[model samples]
Target: MRMIAAVMYEQGLPAPYAESSPLKIEEVELEGPGEGEVLVEVKSAGLCHSDLSQVAGLRKRTVPVVMGHEGAGIVREVGRGVTEFRAGDHVVMTVGSGCGHCSFCVNSRPVLCDTVAASRGKGVLTNGARKLRRNGQALFHHSGVSSFAQYAVTVPGTLVKIDPSVPLEIASMFGCAVVTGAGSVFNAAQVRPGQSVAVFGLGGVGLNSVMAAKIAGASTIIGIDLNESKLPLAAELGCTHALSALDPTLVEKVRDLTHGGVDFAFEISGSKAAMTTAIAVTRKGGEVVCVGLGASADLYQYAHTALVSEEKVFRGSLMGSCVPRRDLPLYLRYYQEGRMAVDRLMSGTMGFDQLNANLDLLDRGEVLRQVLLPNG
Candidate 1:
């Protein structure tokens, strides 16, 4: 098969992930599934900031890679020995593909699987060969699912099977933002019912946090973001309070609403100030989960006074602490039943050629959650 993908050569400099090399869509031959791998004709792929982060060199990963992880499509081909899925199954790609025997994979934290370098990164296929190439050069699949292209090859476990009734556009977002954002709260934070919660950023993850907070029965679900354009959507998603990211009264307002502080706070924006304020706005002994990918290590720092006295619990959650095959289908059901309002999170649909145009919105402080429909 011949497919076009957004390939990155170097990182840093462009907004929404600096592209050391501009992502150009070009035709490349795709590898057939060898063993336990399935080939999906990407129906819809969500363009995540992480993809931008990698291109911009913020998110740590290999380059000369095809960018995109969250995607949904139909299984057109299956590798030999694949028992669970057959061609024609509707599916969403997972970033985490475990060996199913490693301690991390066995412990239900496949997202943290230790063999990340060996598999599930911006490289060639798991079989150690190129799946796609352009002009006699190798083009790697970023995070194992270069869904930005028209087709992708991945392991069976790396895909979450979904029902055919759900629209591919909605299903695509579930592959990442929905699962990561919502899962971080309900699964990682284990948010208690009636607890106070605040989420920073109202993009895909932040909005998912709001929905998850509502599902978790949070009493005060506050959403903060610089874009006043996003608050209306945030409110529709069950955010009880929306604060301007620039408002100086933001922290105090959250504290007042929660009657002291929120019990759980999640920082989903890739902003240093948001991360610090998220930790600060939470009550004593509260938990703060960092869900966004900031520029670098220097982007994050904490004060001892805020931690020692309050007994604040800080954790870096990767992929919502998810076991994808377990969480993806679960969130899919939420969307299918109209309980999640996932359709509300979409910002706009852009054609594949407009990818950079869509990504540029992230740097300009626009775009809530955007997806690219190559099929469109």
Candidate 2:
């Protein structure tokens, strides 16, 4: 089948992100699933900071790679011998395409699986050798799904079944940010009732953190962001308090509000300074969970030993420590029962071509989440 996808290459560099063209897209033929693969007609794809980094050349790339990792789609065809799913099953890609036979996969920690270097990391076909291409030139596949296209040939284990009633367009965000943010709170931090917490950055991920923390029974959920534009939105999304990220006394403000300090602080801003603030606001024995991939080489130069001395648990979280098959339903149920409010998180619904333009809006801090509805 001929499918449209955004394809990248190693050609352009050292130019403005707006113009330093990284990749190009058009209609290309898509292949059928092999032994254990499934063909998904991607219903929606999500935009994440990680994708922006690679496109901007801030992160080294396997250039010529398809830029999407977060995708939600319907199973159009199941591979031979695959018993887990059939055609028309709504699902989200788990990002990690683990070889189920591997030790890490069996344990449900495929995110850190060793095969990233060989399979998804290499842009190869499922066999870890063939590159999906056009006109005899290699076309890179970014993550497991390369979802910035109409259809995807994916390994079965990487698919997480989701509730069909949940709109696939908005549901796609959970494939990454929602899972990352909410997972960090419930699974990673496990904040008990009345706990105090702060999420620095009110983007899609941070907002989820705020909402999750509120649902976790947190008494205080402070939202931090430089954009005054996001403050009102944060308040409506269950944030009990919010402060300008630029406040020089941001940490002190949190301390005064929480009366000592917050029990947990999440670094969702992806800014080095916000990261420092996230760490600074945590109380003794508190947990500071940093979720953003700000820069690969960037480190929290703060005293690591200081955390140990204070008995605080400082750590990083990935994909929200998610078990998607289990957690996706939980989030869906929360939304269904009014325990979580996602209706306001969507800034706009747009066709797939509006992706880059929506990202441009993200750069301007114009919206919380811009979703691409494939059929919109």
Each candidate's lDDT (Cα)?
0.81, 0.77
> Model 2: which residue pairs collide?
8-64
Clashing residue pairs in candidate 1, if any? 12-56, 14-18, 17-56, 18-56
* Model 1 regions lying over 4 Å from their true place: 13-21
Residue lDDT tens for model 2, 1-376:
7777877676334434345445465766676877777888888877776777776656576766766788789999987888898999999876644565678767875556677546765776445634266776667777667888788887776688887988887778878878888888998899889999999888888999999999999999999899988998888887889899888888898999988789999998678888778778889888889887876676667887987898888777877877667787798788778777766677877665566666666766777776665544
Q: How well is each residue in 187-212 modelled by candidate 1, as lDDT tens digits?
A: 89998888989898888888998998
* TM-score, structure 1 vs. true: 0.95
88 in model 2: Cα distance from truth in Å? 1.3
Q: Whose lDDT is greatest here? A: 1
Query: How high is the lDDT of residue 24 in model 2?
Result: 63
Where does model 2 exceed 4 Å of error? 10-21, 116-118, 125-131
